[model samples]
Target: MQNKTRYFIILLILVPVCFSADILLGSTHIPFSIFVDMLRGIEIDETWRIIITELRLPRAIVAVFVGIALPISGLLMQTFFRNPLADPYVLGISTGASLGVALFSLGGGLGMVAIISNFGFASSWGLIIAACLGALMVMLLVVTIAPKVYDTTSLLIIGIMLGSVTSAVVSVLQFFSNPNELHAFLMWTFGSFSGLGWTEIIIMACFIVPLLIISFTMQKPLNALLLGENYAQGLGVRISLLRFQIIIVASLLAGVVTAFTGPIGFIGIAVPHIARMVFKTTNHKTLIAASILIGCNLLLLCDMISQLPGFQSSLPINTVTAMFGAPIVIFVILKGRKSRLHYS
Candidate 1:
């Protein structure tokens, strides 16, 4: 109770501050003094305020959503696989979205056709839907085969195989692409938070917010999930149904972010570990909310740093995320191992 209350309070305070920080600490440092003055209706320079509110502010808001969606997806993936290392991208969703983008960029006439079909959302729709479908397909294959094969390793192998297939297809698309299209596609694949605007943010909010609400609401069943299928089933939880629910929410959350933001690394895999480390429990109720906050703040911080001082062009958001994510994941694994050993 104490911990949950703490997180709830922390979230309200932290989220707003982090949001403000992202607004203030970009390529040009807008001092808190200026930010506060602007907020309080002080007569600041009109140009700076417009730039902050219209441009930089939206990007910061988008980062908060990106942070929320990716980590929550990571949490769902870890729970689904019962593996500490599982991430949304590891299950082939990222690869699938990558493949979809590959098709858009490299397919020439086919790419044009796809776009014209309002399938043109490739820049967004194509990537997101492909990711969602691809994740579901992989999960479906794993669950269906799990009972028959009676081995978790088999499922892992199959997932890797799916990832490979997506990779190969992407490679083929790359080979024949024209230089201009390829360059455009490459730039997008690098990932950045600056691309999203109000329209995209509204679209993201409509989907991600409800999905998170559902994820938390279903936390009890998720906790039951850690005990193994039969154990959970014995507790009156329908394992298959529960897994399906989680996958649906996770896939959509992950796909939507990846679609808009490009394949962001580390957050989906590392954030849960951070949350679990802080909270020290498998109780999904607390774990889910805490993970969201930590993930949001961390990503916001990373986004701010990516737009570093004296770096005029800005580093890709994915690059910053991967840099942070790789170290965080390694730390999580070693700490998790030590924790398990101590418990044993």
Candidate 2:
């Protein structure tokens, strides 16, 4: 308890520092004094004002929410399937979003994709709507089938298969696409926290905040689930309802993040383990809180790194995250294997 409290306090301190770093250390440097003056509502150089207010500020906000949304979605999946490997991507939600984007971007101006892609603000809305619909379609399919499946492993396999199918469809779209459209679609897959304005951020918050609140409320049932479905049911928990809720919440969180930011990979799979190792407990209350802070800080750090401080060129957000996150995931898998081998 003391350790958790201490870590929580440290996280509170680091979050603001990281957030400030995100805004301050970008392609164009904004000096501390100038930034402070700008924040205080004083007029500043036009270029600096636009960069700080329009670009960096919105990007940092999106990073915070993306960080929060993905890890929580991951924690829910890990709990839901009782599998450490389970993540937002594992269930094909992001792949579904990718398919939606592909169809919209490279569907050759067909039907709704053509109409929606033609509008300015509506183009973004079209992508969001298409991604959500694709994700919900998969979620509904999984929900219907999950009840009949006796093993979580089988369900995990089903999700992988679905993702594989979606990927193939995307590949076909890319193959047929012209180079210009293909380049655009490729960049979206690389993931970014930039280019999101206030409107998109608000739309994301509407989905993520309510789902996060509901997830926090499910702590008891989630804790119950850790012991197995039979045990959970024995304790009078409604396993079916709880499973349904978890799916909906996880889907919405993952879906929305993917819609806006593209599919951010390893953070969803890696950050929960970081939380577990740091807090040294499976308790959802602590895990969820720690995951939120750690995830946010880590992504902010990634965003800062992606800016490539010494160079004018910026790296893709997904590239930076995967570089850090993939190693953590590999370490966890190897550690788990060694432990199982020792016990066996």
What's the TM-score of every candidate structure? 0.86, 0.94
- Backbone-clash count (model 1): 2
| Residue 50 error, candidate 2, Å | 1.6
* Model 1 misplacement above 4 A: 1-12, 41-44, 109-152, 335-344
RMSD of each: 3.5, 2.3
List lDDT for all candidates, in order: 0.75, 0.86
Clashes of each: 2, 0
Top-scoring candidate (TM-score): 2
